[model samples]
Target: MSAKYGSGGWATVAIAQSVGATGALIAELGWGVTGPQRVPRLSAVDKSILYRQSVSSRATVVAFAVLPVSVITWLLCDFSRISAIVISLGSLCLAFSPAWFFIGDGKPGQLLAYESLPRLVFVGIAALLIHYDFPIGWYGGALIVGSVTALSLSAICSHLGFFHWKQNWRTIRSQKEVVLGRAISGSFTSFAPALVGLVNPLAVPVFAAVDRLMRMALAILAGIPNRLQSWLGAATGRDRHLRSLMSIRYNCYLGLVSGLIFGLLAPTFVTVLFAGQVSFGYELSALSGFLLFLICTSRGFGLAMVAAGRAKHITISVLCAAGVGVPLLCVLGLYFGAVGALAGQILAETVGIVIQSRILSMKWKSNRQWSTYAASVLQS
Candidate 1:
């Protein structure tokens, strides 16, 4: 895209994706975060019910969200307004994804069938179109086609026909706390590209390009915690605690190694991915690597906390991180450009990881003290 449309056009696409991500989150209403935590213990019937409710709730939000998201993309994009809107729509349509359902159910086949495969086919089609010199806007159109197909496949597979909008709305309202927490937590990262666009529009090409790469890495790394959620959640008492500890340790090591590789390889990868149309330096790569490390490590702690029913702590940690990170990102971006902005991201992620680690420590201490008390009482 950068080769064909230039950096400005690619930057517009990146910002559109960023905005669309936030819209998708809003449409999800925190279900994406909470669904995996609950789905493990549900029966087939109960899981079906949960899926219906999620679709209904998200559908309600999407109805209201689409217009605003399109408007935002139109306002934000400096190039190719139509492409931006199409990409944003595609991103918003992901609200219908059944990925959390399959992940929680341990059904990789279903996940691939219902979500991944359809998208993969459309992405291939998109590549062909791009190669043939179709308008870049068609790439976004392909995304829309892909997402809708995936959603249709999911609906067909599940046989979910009815959605009680009223009942689902009530359920959505009941989960306001979790939804709000997720929204606040997601605000900074999801909107970071738009924020950069606001301050340094020219720098957005470089920053958004790097941010897009980091997001892909983060998604790949996310498989770790997604796997661990089921592993740790399915265990009991002391076993669960032990699993959580192991999960965190494993993620920490992976985070360190991945961060190193990311720092070393990002410059080359970005250049290669963009066909050398856009690129960044080692310094930016290093900062992005540091940010990735903090996030990857903390994901383990966050998921463990969720499994332990300490989700409130995760919310608090995210709140603190966003509160500090957003402003710092904007201020640093204003003065130091992309480098300063990346530094701010590193700081914010660091703050979040510190708070999360502390909370886990406190929980461990509390658990140990309670175990000791119970043992003494039994002995007496």
Candidate 2:
């Protein structure tokens, strides 16, 4: 009993350190070095804190390793020059190795099948059929595989304590409405790669990395305003002060930063990293265009909708827009080439953002007015 207690105590400490580190790194990447101060240290007995710590640490290690390498690969396009593939594989091995060892799994197939089977099969099919290697087809296949991988594995890994966190089997966070919003958010990651995936399956790798990292960044950036608005909306039920204000700020900020980066420096970055063999400006352009749209919707619009209990409307709107936007980008790309193709992407997204924002802003205003009145009556 004494020996077992000692081991678990040490495990908890290790996990706490990991989460603190993860929070620090993400804060650095998203908001820069000057963002928020380090979160409070974990108490050994605090499971949530411990779980957060491990998640943070594992995430930081993974992001720091993957982000730079993906950027380099995007710029250089040469597998030989970038060294990203080897590093990523190696890094995964290292990060997961400790946790993997801690998990005693005598039933290997059972664990793999239940936890990771669907996603593994998806990737296997894509690779074996050269679906990923094929142009156009690669995008769709990769999107299906990649999005599902992040969603499902993140789900599984959490359950198995693979990231050193407690299992949270789909709370309100994973509700149908929230899940719908997340899918819309994920499309920004998926759409650009799918758009150009037909040309080279390998490109999906860099694209997926960039998309995931950027979404992570946006989530961090918009987190504060979104949270504030969400709380207010729940307590008060219609406060645009939190939702609408934050939405525009987040959206415009994403578009501005990403656009500037892609337009000004993407080609140069690609050149240095790819060793000048492959180019990624067009790829970056497509990605930035779609992501910019997402930032606009996510930062402000989506938060407002959920707070007002209008997630169903938001989800439907996103689906309809995607239905129109994706096909349009494909058709445009077919006729006009990649640049022209992305222009259509930009157009579709702008239209979607505008429609959602306007409608949601109105809802927010009306709801807040009613909420303020109710609060006043209660106080009286």
Q: Residue-wise lDDT of candidate 2 within 147-227, one digit each (tens)?
A: 335434544653533333344222222334534543553242233444534443333434433343444445445434433
Q: Write one digit per residue (lDDT tens) for candidate 1, span 1-380.
A: 78777887789888998888888877888776678768888888888788878878888888898999999999998687887898888888877777877777777787788678888888788878877877676777777787677667777876744354658768879667777667776667888888888887878889888888888898888777787777775788988888888988888888888888999999999999998889998999998888888888887787778767777667788888888988988888888888978887888788888898888888889989999999999999
Q: Each candidate's TM vs. the true structure?
A: 0.94, 0.46
Candidate number of the best lDDT: 1
- Once model 1 is optimally superposed onto the true structure by TM-score, how far is the C-alpha of residue 27 displaced, in angstroms? 1.8
Q: Tell me the lDDT of model 1 at 36.
A: 79
Ten-residue stretch with the least lDDT total in model 1? 157-166
